[model samples]
Target: MRSVLAACLLLGLAHTARAEAPLTLRFVAPERYTDAQSRTGSGPTLRTTIGGLERIFRDLAGRTLHPGQSLTVDVLDVDLAGTDLPGAGPTAPRLVTDVTPPRLRLRYALRERGRVVLAAEETVTDINFLLRARPGGSSSLAYERDILAAWFGARIARREPPRG
Candidate 1:
C-alpha cells in the first residue's frame, strides 16, 4: 500500500511539473504607411520609405519578448496589391500599386500546436508611435505577445523570472 501511494504521488507531481509545449510565430508586415505627411499645401507628387516603420516593430517585439529571450522572427513583406487610387488630376484613371511600392512591411503572428492563435496589425507612421501599449503589464494591447510570453512553453527569457 505504501509503495502504491508513493507511486501515485510521484506521478501526480510529475504531471504537475510538466509544462505545455512552446509556441512560435512568424511576423509579417500589415498594409499601411510607416510614415506619411499630410499634403496640406501640395507641391510635387511624393512618397516615403518605410524603413523607420520596421524599426518600430523591432522595438516593440524586443520589449515584449522575455527580456533577453530572442524571438525567432520570419518577417513577410506586407501586401498592398490592387489598391484603387486616382492621381490628383482629373483624367487620371485608377491605379493599383504593388504592396511593396516603397518601404516593406512584415506580419508577426504567434504560433503553438502548429497554429496561429493570436495576431495584431501595426503600421509605420512618420509621426509618433505606430501604436501605444496597454496600461500595466497586462499586455492587454496585444493578446499574441501577452499570452504567449506567459503560457508559451519553454522559457525564452535569459534573465530569471521576476520574483514577487
Candidate 2:
C-alpha cells in the first residue's frame, strides 16, 4: 500500500511539473524602433507593437497557459509601411507612401523556472494588407498586431495544456 501511494504521489508530482504558471512577459528592443518618421503614413513603433503583442499573449495566457509560464521577446527589426522620400531632408516636410504593408522581426523564448521550453526567431509581415480594410477602427497597424498575436498564440497553444 505504501509503494502504491508513493507511485501515485510521484505521478501527481510529474503532472505538476508539466503544469504552467501565469505568463510573465518581457520585451527587449531598440528605442528608435518605435519612432514615427512621417505623419502621412507609418506603421507602429516597436514599443506599440510589443504592447499589442503582450495584450494578445495575456489573453492567450488566461485561456491557455497553466499559471507561471513566461515569455521574453527581443525585437530585432521593424520596417514600417511607406516609402522614404529621396529629396526630403530633415528640415523638409515628411511625405510617405501608405500603400506598403509592414514587417516585424523578433526573437522570443518561452520559459518555466528559468529553463527555456521554446525559442524562436520570426519575421511577421502583412504584404497583402488584408487586415487593413477591416472596419471597427482597425488600422493597418492593428492588422499587423492581430497577425502576430494569432501566430504567436497558435504556437503557444501547441505547448499549452488542453482546455477543459
Candidate 3:
C-alpha cells in the first residue's frame, strides 16, 4: 500500500510539472518601440505597460486556447492609440483623435501537442478605434488592449493557417 501511494504521488507530481502556460510573451528592443513608455507623469511606466500587455495576452490565450494548445508572441513594435500633444504638460492627457490610431506589430507561433501549427508576423491596427463602440469604458490601456484582443480573436484563437 505504501509503495502504491508513493507511485501515485509521483505521477501526480510529474503531471503537474508537465502542465504548460497557454501563452509565452517576449518584447524585443522595447526601448525602440514607438510609443510604449508613459507620456504623462501619472501614466503607467514602461515596466507597467509591458507587464499589462503580457497579462492580457496570457488571459486571452488561457480563455481561447485548448488544453494542448500554446502560443508564443514576440512583440516587435507598438504605437499607442493617441499622441501626446507637443509641449503638453506632464499631467496632460494623451490626446485621442481620428488620425492617431493604435497599432501593434508582432510575430507569433501557435503550437499543439508539441507540433507547430501556425506562425505569422502581423501588424494590427484599429483606424477607427475612437469611433467604434467599445465595451470597456476608459480602462487603463483600454485602446491598446482592445486592439490586442481583436487580433487574438481573429488570428490566434481562430487557429488560422500559417502565413508565408
Candidate 1 lDDT, tens digit per residue, 2-78? 99999999998886554221223343342333222223222111122133323444555455554223334444443
Q: Give the per-residue Cα lDDT of candidate 2 at 11.
A: 96
Report clashes for each candidate as comma-separated counts.
12, 8, 0
Candidate 2 to truth, TM = 0.52
Q: Estimate each model's TM-score.
A: 0.26, 0.52, 0.79
Maximum-TM-score candidate: 3
Poorly placed runs, candidate 3 (over 4 Å): 1-18, 39-42, 86-92, 161-164
Weakest lDDT window of 10 consecutive positions for candidate 2: 34-43
Q: What are the per-residue Cα lDDT tens digits for candidate 3 across 1-164?
A: 99999999999998876676668789999999988776555445678778878887887777888998878899999887777665565445677788888888999888898798888888888887877637656665788878878787878778655344
Alpha carbon lDDT of each predicted model:
0.34, 0.57, 0.79
What's model 3's lDDT at 109? 89
**Strongest candidate by lDDT:** 3
The per-residue C-alpha lDDT of model 3 at residue 117 equals 87
lDDT string for model 2 (42-127, tens) is 33434555666567656756765554566666666656555445455433422324455566676777776668897887776656
TM-score (C-alpha, index-matched) for candidate 3? 0.79
Better of 2 and 3 by lDDT: 3
